[model samples]
Target: MPLRALFGLLLCAGCAPLSAQDATRAPEPNTRVPAGVVRYAPSVFPDRIVLSPAQDAAHGFAVAWRTDATVAAPVLEIVTAGDSPDMGTPRQVRASSRELRTENGIARHHRADVDGLLADTLYAWRVQGGGTWSAWHHARTAPAPGAPLALLYFGDTQNKNVSLTTRVVREAMRHAPDARLALFAGDLVSGGDGEDDNEWGEWFEANESLPTSMAVAPAPGNHEYFEEFEDTPRERRVLGAHWPLQFALPGNGAPGAERTSYWFDYQDVRVAVIDGTSALDLGTAQAQARWLDGVLAASPHRWNIVVTHQPFYSPRAGRDNALLRKHLLPVIRRHAVDLVLQGHDHVYGRRLPGEAPTPVFVVSVAGAKQYRLSEQAQRTMRPVAEDTQLFQVVRIDGAHLRYEARTATGRLYDAFELRDDGSAKSLVDLPEGRIDERRCERAKTLKGRADRCWE
Candidate 1:
């Protein structure tokens, strides 16, 4: 089949083509993350450290992490940092606790929602292991509502992630340490059986060091829901049973997908999250379809970013997610979304915002897994294939949003800027950097081992 067939059309149902963002020269090269951060112990287990979906309210942030049985009630504390180590003691804010368990056995995870915070303020935090603590990670929260912002996004983190994935994520953090929001659009694990559990652990440990001030908004990958079944297709399985307990989310559902699909307002941006599994596996799209339409209709925010696991449009050949496109694309278009993020293909992709006011749809992977693109891959701007590990940093400042995708070596791969001036187009390309084509064709299309690519 032709590559175009693999990804069905991703155009808006009734929207007309808006003018494209004037493609400008890429931004300057990003600096590397200091060596002090991104360090880990062989025995320390910090799988899947992350910021939750409920970050809209300025003073709040959420995080979750897993540990070896020896680690106690995993806790996170925030402290302020000065110009140098010579600076005085920092402020400390601890997250209230909710203990969670891993379906794979033995490994327990910690989920915390930190509220009552200050906006655009610099703070350092550490995830505590019993009496001891993880590294002193640093970050800042989103600007006050109606303020401009920036964000970074990644797709899947599903592979030999224990040691490798950290560098890719750190690369993004180094580019913009105070990043306001980070989006993980699924496949954070492999999700088949053993791999899903293990990879989630690795993925968490990978990012715990950088979320000091920035917040992350993640969607559950399809692998997150692989529980067994008795009737449906006999071979197919339901999503896993442990997701709800793993992370505490805002129960703000659209209409039908209460916990599975939800939305929250972050300052000037209203981000919506969904579980494609519910829509695809069960006939629940009707409810979420209505819910999404309502959420968008009710949104008063200046920006909208939708988070899902399946791409409305695929970057590789032979992959199809038509059902999702049928139910959600029209809604996304009608809402005039600014961004739609997903991961299934282990690559980096961004579609300049749209047939509507929305300008970009991106897919990024943080795990060790990578995939190949088609001959016309260049036609897909900022398409980074298998072999190269990467992550993005998106900062929203005033009316403009700046984004930089940094490679594992801390080099800027691609950068763009978007403005909210009611213009149809908004992608400002970077000036110069390495575009690793080394692993461009790392793996053939759909190699059946996508399972290995996860936990």
Candidate 2:
């Protein structure tokens, strides 16, 4: 059967293509103060507001935010968004709150699970902390099962988040204004531990209020882990404190890995997030592997995508993640996963299906960090980029999945189309005249002196 026959030919049903003019336009600089320049301390008002998808995104969703301890009990108010000024009677839900101690001070985090929503419905919501209500934000539920879908995927936004990464993130949003979800491959923060409040603040500020409307699914990166000393010479690296306190993820993940390793469905796609850091260093590799095998074995969705912080195929020279690949690659290959989106190498490389075990393996960096590509990657990955920040837009309609990677300023960097006709899959690279491959030899100023190659 033809792929279009198997799945309807709606190709990004609700998404508008980024016009050639818009694609090549210059990126606007962020006006907000960079998180690196100032401290982002929690206050009496609600901040860091974010939304995450539920196990069944069509029926439910999760929202989380941070506030000062004085707020006590916070509440979330929601209603079907309407064009009229009056939103009718609103539904109120009390949030579950938790107290957290950060380097800045003590703050409270609140999460509310909003369920029983109609599929593909648009709703408006707001959070209240200390009698102050945040500006109402709009969110739409996922399309009905088997419907066309669109989403955004980002690589590491670890360094210079507000200053440098925000431009890339905003540019991606411009290209896919109606994207339902924003997926992060991890290393969300540069701080490897201690949960730097300033960095977290910068990350949220960089994203602004975009996450309140779109859901976020982030995998754990090594930068989100650190060693803790407790009367032992060698302390195990543990997940940072900011992770759980900031995002309210679905609790339906691997037992040992919990939030860091989980899976969720959005329309016909099943996104499985793997906790590569904990799996490799925290002795949970086997457990996650088993859990992953089971997850993929039981997935009923038409497309399966795995998101992680560490790449199965390393793009940077001398940065191979052998253990991670050994533990997870087999499971990924066995299940014939459609795509494996990853970060951690701080370079961009996309290996097509035949070249790699999976149909597509992409390693990209969205922040200021850049690294030299390995000889293997240069030879295998056709459109690799370095010294460049990029973002990807992925769209799934019936039997076709279209992927486009664009530069921070909105230029089309690389693109491809994947079609699955129930039994077989085919891939076609889409770019004919892509911008020049960004490598260190053309760089005027070197960044990350020790880790990144200056050439």
Candidate 3:
């Protein structure tokens, strides 16, 4: 974890080569296993079942899964849960299936829409892979309009130690069992564009409960993009090979930003996922900017939440996303976005609640990767954490939004409340006992040790 190695790791998404001083540093560990060698085996069972919010969550939901090539026609069996003990017969919905070839092998990806669902009602569903069937899973649709809601937010759970990262996700879920939605602010895997099936598998396995129950909303991060060759740098990169096939997202977004950048409403909150990487690299910034304006202007929800991989107000020095700030921040501010959740800096940071119109900007990390806090971060953000893995839970009720950040060990690290009046809003910092910040002296000593760090 020398300075050179740190720079290489931080700039890996841009495909930057390691410096000469980093040549002797140990290579980052690869966590993929043989079992993750994505291959197709025609079995009756389906895997990777994920549930996502449709444009209209009250009356619709989307499900996506993977099956072997033999499963020519994938199907979903869904039914309303009965009041009594006996379960009723389910109506079958045929799913659209597609073949996706990856470095591991070829597999069939299937997706289906469940429409006309009763609002706030319990429903059971299962997927069919040829003659095989998955276990019945249940999920609840969004409640009546304006009802109170809670959700969990996670930052980058990207690489090397998924086992360690999975625990944090599970712990967050355990702490917020009532949460109806889970938001992943990008970089679900270390080598998404490279088709690292093992890393993808580990990520999927880590959140087994979410896909079956809670609706998942994910944004794409720079690491999610991979170049044609590992050593080629960032000259050529594309969205991860697994993205489109892995999640069924809303299509109402910028023409080219479907699935990756979209907006959906749940109860009183409108959550918008913006494609920061696309804006930064693909020249989709203007399109997304206009779409964002329209989405927010048209939203009737009580709270507006925006999720992106890169922070407009960067928490790390020498990592400012000025382009994003210039193109998207104005729109975010104009719309009075209530909360902006972000990742990619590998640290936890929050700009103290300020004057009117400025949304709560937060950058956090939930994986094992750690980064040092910069002078700019220390000077601007209060209650920032370096070398700490954290998760957030947000609850929305009428005009009030409550946010809490917690460590992997269930310690409360940060908390705040944002209350909206008819015309403007107010911010209140919630006091909590937090662990002492990890400093450079201790961090430098831990470099290349169990916990990677350096100055």
TM-score per candidate, chains pooled = 0.72, 0.88, 0.88
Q: Which residue pairs clash within candidate 2? A: none
- Per-residue error (Å), model 1, residue 408: 2.6
lDDT score, candidate 3: 0.80
lDDT of 1 by residue, 243-322 (tens): 76456567787565666677777777788888777787767766777888888898987677788887777776677678
Candidate 3 worst ten-residue window by lDDT: 443-452
Error of 1 at 60 (Å): 2.0
* Count of steric clashes across candidates, in order: 45, 0, 1
Provide the lDDT at 380 for model 3.
87
Clashes of 1: 45
Model 3, span 245-266: residue lDDT tens: 8898888878667757999989
Ranking by lDDT: 2, 3, 1
- How well is each residue in 1-455 modelled by candidate 2, as lDDT tens digits? 34432222233222223343433445433223344443666787889999999989998898999998898888899999999979998899889999988777889999999999999999999999887988899999998777778899999988768888789888988899989999999988877434477778889988986788799999989888877784598778887888887898999788789868888889989999999888888888888888999999999987899999988888887877777777888898889898899999988999745753345899988987777778899988878987788999999998899888899999888888888877788787887757877765421222213335321
Error of 2 at 138 (Å): 0.7
Off by over 4 Å in 3: 1-28, 32-44, 83-85, 192-195, 229-234, 439-455
- Whichever of 1 and 2 has more TM-score, that candidate is 2
